[model samples]
Target: MTEPTFFETPQPVDLATIAEWAGAELVRGDGAAEITGVAPVEAARPGMLVFFDNMIYADRLAATEAAACLVTKKHQAKVPDHVAVLVCKDAYKSWAQVLSKLYPAAVVPADPGPNTISERALVDPAARLERDVRVEAGAVIGAGVEIGSGTVVRANAVIGPGCRIGRHCVVGPNVTVQHALIGDRVYLHPGVCIGQDGFGYAMGPQGHLKVPQIGRVVIQDDVEIGANTTVDRGANRDTVIGEGTKIDNQVQIGHNVEIGRHCVIVSQVGLSGSCKLEDFVAIGGQSGVRGHVTIGMGAQIAAVSVVNDDVPVGGRYGGTPAKPVKQWFREVTALRKLAERTPST
Candidate 1:
């Protein structure tokens, strides 16, 4: 299979030209140098542009093979004499801006490679099933289930009556989806059970009764769910995942969980029911949160952290009972200091 040739435009741009195009403040070294590629400082070759966003990597930038580099205004003087530097107010932001322009995202079509669809299955008239969308012998789909250009629906991957799967999305083997609106460039790995019953129970004097989950799952664009990651159906409202959210394998999302855009949820992270994680929040591996908690925007919960209450925005937290990142660092530092001062036998 031939991969789509992006970045194949042979327009070799110069350092000064790229800096000007990206609205960066240019510091000249060799304006005539032709830049053929963009890479990291450590891996950049001759004729490529590298970027130094953090101070920790300043020394590495001096030894880089890149003909030019992007740097922050504060760090411009630190660059070596041989390399041309493009100064920007924000190095990371500028780097992202430049790289995005150089290499854009792609959506590839899925070919249903030799799968047979049974006559009993109902494929939507308006849907475009790519190469391998196999309607299992007994599976059914509602109207307007537009499978993307390259999406494959394996045997028994029962898509709900009215769902929209974007391009290159794999309705993973045996996965069941219902009453959901999925976005483009989405990937659903095998055994991913979406729109399932929520774990809601009411305990009374007589017995415990289960609360009916009447909500659905709304997975947005550029989302990739790991294998077997089960997103429970909402109790009353939809469980929403913002665009570009990547969920790792074996993660369990409870009912009514609202995960904001671009969040990275690592493996085995269990979000309790009704937890709202705002934009750019990162949940480390094996992290678990209590129900009804709100993790504010840009907050990071370290691996294995147990969040029991609401977290503030931009806070970094760690430990079993999660605390502020600064506090966690201080506790570790104090412990180390105490050990150093202790009298040994």
Candidate 2:
């Protein structure tokens, strides 16, 4: 199968325009030069923009054929005379801005065609869609669903009955959303399963009794969930994902897990039932938090850790049962030294 261009073709932009977009000073290059694309320093060609932020890539920077390079004040002199140097406080941050300006249509699940709504989509007569909403082919909008203006329901996505999707949101292909209220500018990537039944069961000697789950999933504004992540609905309350929180792919969030605003949950992390993560708390990849535990504001849990207790505010924890990061490292070091000193058994 041939590859598809999901983003629109970027137009050629001048050096002056790129400098303004990146908020960088055109310290040593012709402002009139035109750039057509962006590339890494190692493979940059003429009319392409590149970034040089680290000294480790000095060799690559010296040999780069890019028309212009986004660099820091410290690396300005290292850039070749033939290349235009745009100095900034943070080269990487400025590069990000430039990329966004150059590729404005690079959102997940490419925009549906010129027409607002596709004729092939199955939208219920009772569903209320605001103006300019785009429903792509094979998408199913169930009864009583209210979709805000400027939202795009990508191909094959299903929005179940009574669900409310806010404006400017992107419901990616194959996404399944039910019993949820999604906020504005939220992005649900492909294969994401939202508002599913939580794992709630009562133990018994003969058999396990299933508990009834009746709560919804509340995803706040500006939040982006990665592909294939599964968020379970609450048993008796809403499973809340707060504003601006970003969740990575394949993460499993159990029933009643409350993630606070701006928290970052990395890939493969698991939060058990009723656990709470305060604002700005960050959990590293593959970490597991126990049920009913609370992680205080600004706390960080290191990668591959198993958190079994409440973590204090602004603390940094790691390891199984997750103690303070510093103590955990010291114990690991001591154990390594002791093993080195011991003779063979």
Residue 130 displacement (Å), model 1: 13
Q: Assess the local accuracy of residue 60 in candidate 1 as a C-alpha lDDT between 0 and 100.
A: 84
lDDT of each: 0.82, 0.93
Q: Candidate 1, 335: how far from true, in Å?
A: 3.2
RMSD of each predicted structure: 5.7, 2.3
TM-score of each: 0.71, 0.91
Runs of candidate 1 exceeding 4 Å displacement? 1-11, 30-32, 105-158, 165-176, 183-193, 199-212, 220-229, 243-251, 261-268, 279-282, 313-315, 338-345
Minimal lDDT window, size 10, model 2: 106-115
Model 2 bad stretches (over 4 Å): 1-9, 54-58, 74-78
Residue range 31-64, candidate 1, lDDT tens digits: 6678898888889888888878787887788788
lDDT per residue as tens, model 2, 110-209: 5566647789999999999999899999999999999999899999999999999999999999999999999999999899999989999998999999
